[model samples]
Target: MIDAIRDYWNHRIHDLEMTDQPVGTKRFFEDLDEYRFDKLHYLPRLVDFSGFRGQRLLEVGCGIGTDLVRFAKGGARVTGVDLSQTAIDLARKNFELNGVNAEELVAGNGEALPYADASFDVVYGHGVIQYTADAPRLIQELHRVLKPGGTGLFMVYNRVSWLNALSKVMQVALEHEDAPVLTKYSIGEFRQLLAPFAETSIVPERFPVKSRLHKGWKGVAFNTMFVGTFNALPRAWVRPLGWHLMAMCRK
Candidate 1:
């Protein structure tokens, strides 16, 4: 199962559809970064990618080192690990081309991290747990590597989200839905997965944004009708139905 997941990601880079620049080039990374921030505008506002200066930060499954680079630029001593060597290679190129440095960027399994206990000041696994073969085991490893009172930031898909319902209604598949392992968790289920943490808070985010991927009438309806309608609703009432469940954990 793990091998299948790795092989799949090795061939398919996340958000590859957003860029036409040649892979591993500076333009490619820049395009991806721009598109990512545009789509996930809430990420930097919520994650404080610049707050941990001179601190040790580890990002598990850090695809192409996008967020990792941001942390590094902000003076965090960053290391990245990914299941796909292709991702690691591209990440290294991204860092080199951007004139930043990482402590390390190795291809490794998140379920069994290759570090001593309490080794990092922060551990991050954004959009990673849902695709792992053993989500609980990966969470355990993340907690194990964090120093006392260290932080863990994670994001996963919400099964009870508006996007999920819309996808089903429109008969459109979610990105990477055909992967070897893809799981979505309800709020209660996500909380249960982070039981090892001393404290945890889950925030529902990634609300309806205009589509850059979808096309035709379905896309038009989503962009014209759904986006406006959903955002127009009282946020308090629709907050729980957000597509991404972002968790902040303390060890």
Candidate 2:
């Protein structure tokens, strides 16, 4: 089943890349941002790792290597791994297009990574864990590859959020809800899951208004109200309202 899904996405990526598209265009951000807010949220957290001039960084599930290129441009010795061959090919092409030097691109599984213990200074998995069959095991693998006290940045779907709940309902209504709720995570639950390996911190963020599929002031009003209400309360109080969740863990 997993291999079949991998093949499906691989084909999708190949079709997407054949069109020769840019990364941050309106189409790219609009399509991906509905569920992924990492690009907006990463820069703030990455400020701490700004001086990674000679550091080694590993990215798991690096689709098309968009973020890999950014890490390379920032001077990190970078490697990207993905299950999709098409994504790997696009990543290599993107690396050349962006003029960023990357060490390697490996096609493999995230649950059982192919790197040695304590091999990398930083390990990143953004918007990737939700799709894995065993997220905790993947986290453990990430922990295994990091040097002691090294950092890891991960993004997962927020289970205890209004937007996610709505998405679930929508899927059910559309008769497209066969897949398990693989993308959802709550802060407390995630912390407990990562407790054995690293100290974890959760940051809740709002998907930007610009990326909404609905146009005009009505769309803006709805998203703004939702985010404002959700962010106004503490997680204990509003854990059931936000759209997505991000967790940053240190190994």
Candidate 3:
């Protein structure tokens, strides 16, 4: 299963590293002209990249070095690891192109990180671990690499999200409900899985307002009609029902 994941990413990275497919609508933030389109949310101002200044940080799956570059530029001593050699190569090229550099970048597996234990002040993995077969193992690896009291953060699709509920309702309404397995996690489930490794918790607090949810008239209509209103709600109200479940743990 792990090898299958490596093979999957080896091929997937070709498109993921080079494409801009942010969710919501095609005309939203899906600007391919900007190479960093896929990574801006994880950067400062939006997600507090500046907080990493002078910190030792590791990004477990630094695709194309987008966030890695941001961290380095933010004054972090950054190191990156990814399962795909091609991704690491592209990341190096991107860093050079952007005049950003990291302390190290290596091709590596998330479930078995290559760094020494207790080596980093912060570790972050965004939208990466679900691709691996054993997310719990990856979490353990993340915990292992962090210094005591160090922070760890990750983003995974929320299985109990409003969008998920809508997907199921849509499927049932259309009489096309088929179980397509995706590695999604509910907040409680993720917290439980990581409890032994750290003081862990998760919150559903993001919506794909840029990437088109689906590629049809119905999808377009849904986004046009409901997405804006949904986003307009207070984050405190929307946090638990959001699409992306953010897990924060301390080791």
Candidate 4:
């Protein structure tokens, strides 16, 4: 199962379809960065990309090192690991193109990471826990690698989210839905997975945004009708319907 997941990602880097820029070039990385932040507009508001200055950080499943580069530029000593060597290779080029240095970047499995216990000040695994073969094992490895009182930032799809329902209703598949492993968790289920943490807070985020991928009438309706109506509703009323569950955990 792990090998299958690795093989799948080895061919498909996240959001690779969004760009025509030459792969491994500066513009290619820039395009990906723009697309990511635009879609995940809540990311910077929630996670302090520049707040980890002078700290050691590890990003597991850091695809092409997009977020990792931001952490490095903000003065965090960053190391990245991915099961896909293709991503690691491109990540090296990404850091080089951006003129930022990373502590290291290697191709490795997240469930059994290659680092000492308590080795990092921050461990980040966004959009990765769900795709791994063993989510609990990967979570435990992330916890094991963090120093006492260190932070762990993670994200997984919300099983009981508006997007899930919309996908079913509209008969559209979520990105990577056909992967070897893709699990979604409810709020309570996600909290249970973070049991090793001393303290944790989960925020349901990734609300409706205008689509750049979906097309035809479905896209038009979602962009014209759904986005406005959803955002117009009182946030408190629709809070739990968010598509992504963002968790901030302390060891």
Clashing pairs in 3: 22-210, 22-211, 23-210, 23-211, 23-212, 24-210, 24-211, 24-212, 149-251
Better of 1 and 3 by lDDT: 1
Number of residue pairs clashing in candidate 1, backbone atoms closer than 3 angstroms, sequence gap of 3 or more or interchain:
0
How far out, in Å, is residue 86 in model 1? 0.7
Cα error, residue 186 of model 3, in Å, equals 1.1
- Candidate 2 minimal-lDDT segment of 10 residues: 172-181
Tens-digit per-residue lDDT, 77-186, candidate 1:
99999999999999999999889999999999999988999999999999999999999999999999999999999999999999999999889999999999999999
What is the overall TM-score of model 3 with all chains considered together? 0.80
List, residue by residue over 1-251, the lDDT tens digit for candidate 3: 66666666666652342344542223221243254444234334335677879999999878767677767877888999998787787678767766777888999888888789999999999777666677789888988989999988777777778778877776523111121214777777777767855576676665546433255766776678767878787878777887677777788
Cα-based lDDT for every prediction: 0.95, 0.67, 0.70, 0.96
Distance (Å) between predicted and true CA of 38, model 3?
A: 8.6
As for lDDT, the candidate ahead, 1 or 2, is 1
**Better-scoring candidate (lDDT), 2 or 3:** 3
Tens-digit lDDT track for model 4 on 81-176?
999999999999999999999999999999998899999999999999999999999999999999999999999999999999999999999999
Off-target runs (Cα >4 Å) in candidate 4 are: none
Q: For candidate 4, report its TM-score.
A: 0.99
Q: Each prediction's TM-score against the native? A: 0.99, 0.76, 0.80, 0.99
* lDDT, candidate 2, at 152: 85
RMSD (CA, angstroms), candidate 3: 5.4
Worst lDDT 10-window in candidate 3: 172-181
Q: Which candidate, 2 or 3, has the higher TM-score? A: 3
